[model samples]
Target: MRAFLLLLFVFLTLGAAPARAQQPTPTRVIEALYDQLSAYQLRRYQPDSGYQLLTLPSTFSGPELAALRLRERQLVRVDLVYSAYRFDPKFSQRQLNIDRLRNLDERLPGLLMDPSITWNLIEQTGCTTPDECQQYFHGFVLYIEKRYTKADTKAEIGRLTARLNATEKKIERIRAVRKSPGKPLACGYPHVEDKLRKLTKRIKKAYDCTQKDRRPRTVTFQAEVSRQGKVLNVRLPAVDSAGAAAPPCPEELTGAIAEGLAFTDGFLLGKQRLPFTVTGRLSLPLRPQQGFKVTGYYLADSLMRKYRVKLLRDGCQARQLRPGDATEEDPIPNPDPNVVTRVLERHPDWQKQTVVADVTGSMYPYTADLLIWLQLAAAGPEKTFVFFNDGDDLPDKQKRLGQTGGLYDARTNDYGRIRQRVIEAMGAGGGGDAPENDCEALLRAHQLAPEAQDIILVADNHTFPRDTKLLEGTRLPVKIILCGVTDHINPKYLALARRYGYSLHTLDTDLTNLSELPDNQITIIEGVRYQTTPGGFRRVSGRAE
Candidate 1:
């Protein structure tokens, strides 16, 4: 295998059936602006206290009108692209950029929003999905093109002509008094008509292409590059509805390139090889039946036996199971053959099982499996459930201050209602910022179901438990029913688990008998297989064997 293959992942087949690729729609830009930043335009440009980059600035006699119009459109284009792109998690340095925009400095990380720059910043970032970033950029520009119809263009041309006549009359009056036409005015206005004519032609061409090219055939990869320009490593990552994952870089396709596929500078940012991260897609002409082991990427990352060193965290407080860490009692045979069902079976004597879940947008997608979990594992009268949103649901929750605040809008009880709440929240669609109030929910669940012996915290791996302070007083050992966990386990979560004696349990959604699962429910980072342990993913049997 090439060293790049070591990085991880294989080709991702984004769609099925024969059709052109999807086109970008500009309206999404408007929608995102209102959704994230709470920004909405009341009407088209007019003189107002609010900022409007495209406000009709002045009547133009010649080229300046062309210059101003071009500048305004460029800024508008930047505004539209950035507004949409910011929503993507990979676009980091987000908080800093958002802070600036919310404060009214029309600048983005790359573009200053200055009229002087035409914004070549349209360059795309490399990623696991090939050409996705650049393709989106093309879609955005075309969206802008399609948004302005031919009627709208004609109207603008007529309006500019009117402005030109007025300006020309004023210039004639001024010139009559000036015998000494000292320095010739460096007005670029004379070029406006030609410039606009060319612009309209270009926009029409792009619009036509947008109509013709529904999708582009391409692939994207993400890698850590060294100063030497060598591929230090590459791996495809994914996100769990419960949290997030690195983007997918399909392996079967990647491995197809073998040891030495050199991506041109198109994949790299700038000419310099200084250590940095790069993610991009390249167009590839691949044929069907080209499949290899697309599942290995996940297998290697999530199921690999590599573990943390013996000692863990501040003052060596965390403990790893010694090699001989088996209980003296013969292992409790799992009643449910399903890999995930064995999680609750960890403590056989426990009569009642209590599940405390982070039932948010991410968890909602797994509703089918969730129903399976409830029906199969949590169905008995001995089982009780507690559900809540982030910290806001609990009164004692502390605020993170500058970072994300708890968005706990949910609070419910009973086994029956729990399912409905999770589905509703999932459909309603606000996962909130990264950190959830999982701590408070856990704390509350403990109080309500104090008698339940085995407490399972159904955690979304992306969000960390912020209520460690409450856990400080927790007497009962909590077994984490880790939901949506994939290839990479957050070391911090493991550290906390070590400190609290919480043994982690994840699902193997691929159980032959339980194949009703939708794609989102199986949260592994990449595709991998786990050994059939007596209880969950407790050990790794060489996957190859």
Candidate 2:
């Protein structure tokens, strides 16, 4: 009887061993855990940000783990174990609740040391289906080293303060120029046709493009005018190789013309005689159109509609002129220039830039300016352009901070291809919200142009960037050319510049640094008062002290 009982016990124990063998081994379960964690990391990781991943062995001491956690930025960790739970109709939350509690522990079990060990107790699932479904527990240990440390951000703050001091000095120089008086010149005031004729004769010798193409074409030129009515600088559009194929006019001509040109009065915006840029044209084959026609090139058409502009007197009059004498182009017609134009005009030294623009509908005005600037500037392979819509028609809920993407970049200086990329990004998505994925676009721009000298971010003033957290991962010097700023600047941008050492630029003001100011110190910029605080900064209320 004893021999028969022993045989039955052995047979029953063998049957249970086969059932346990069907479950996944600890190694397979840990592998599955890493797969899930990797998906989460993929969403936020920036290229070249320097992150380390580690899968600690189960035998790792608790003290060692604590030391690692102290030295590195503990991005995230997952602690779980893999085991099958019995199918249950009523207790579906049972297995999930237990697994979560286990993950919350400071130290996870060393599953690698005992691959064959089991919890022994089976938990019930919350499954409600008529058919049976299998359920299992998951376990893993994932550590992601963070990129930015507290010390890194602190050092950037110091740099920002230094930059701000330098900017203040630059403002002083600008103010001195603005205070000067408009000089008297031989040119008559507002005699548009007569003055144009005289001016054209002065520049006829320097208008070299006409020598190459006898075709009647209007080449437009833009000049900056100080509030004191002094002509500060001049720029002519790059030769249209696709069209007239003329070479750029001589630099000597631009310098000579700038030296001679002066307005009777500085351009006025409201009560202030602010600096402005004016556009005029040098038409080839010096002859007036047979019918009445506009004198200035169509370059400033958008600028005219957006700002108050006066034509030097519309409608061209017929006049015969000699080859050595071109018609005097109408005197400068001031247009309130946008940010893109201002940055390109003021910073001629900013070359080989990777220009990243937000291409939502709100940015159309600046987008037009960007296209215009690109058309006028000399083309080079080093200049890269990137345009982004918030997401490629992505639904709002699915948009994650650093991952939301509707970004396209063109490395070549080909205007046609650049324009196509702009169209492609815009077509993919209409910027969904007022807050944009600006930092995300910037990060992608850096990835595309890793060796670029600097990043020129053309941004909107009203909206704040959505992924500012990722700014810490950026490597290049960011020059933010902000648009739509009128009465007040956005404080979020101020904080960004302060924390990351980015320079903030508008039409007239450049905030290179926002650190070292005493708390509650008020600084006026471009007529707007801003108060600095430990938290960041804000547009001051009421009048300045």
lDDT of 1 by residue, 290-322 (tens): 311111111122211221111212211111234
Total clashes, candidate 1? 41
Error of 1 at 316 (Å): 66
RMSD of each: 38.4, 24.0
Query: Candidate 2: what lDDT?
Result: 0.54
Weakest 10 consecutive residues of candidate 1 by summed lDDT: 291-300
Error of 2 at 503 (Å): 1.2
**Candidate 2 deviant stretches above 4 angstroms:** 1-336, 473-475, 516-518, 542-545
Candidate 2 matches the true fold with a TM-score of 0.40
> Candidate 2's residue-wise lDDT over 1-545, tens digit each?
24334433433444334312323334333333222121111111122222244443334566756765633333322333222233454543334533443332324343212211111111223333334322322333443423322353334334433443454455445446433323221211222223555555555644555566566665556777666767789876677424654434557657755754666555443344455566666556544332112233221345333332334454212222223331122211113356888877888777646989987756766776676566545565657777988877576557786888888887887865776677677666666644578888888888887887779999977566766767765556788998877654666677677777788888888777675566667787677556665545655433100
TM-score for candidate 1, please give it.
Answer: 0.29
Error of 2 at 136 (Å): 66
Clashes of 2: 8
Best model per lDDT: 2
Per-candidate Cα lDDT values, in order, are: 0.36, 0.54
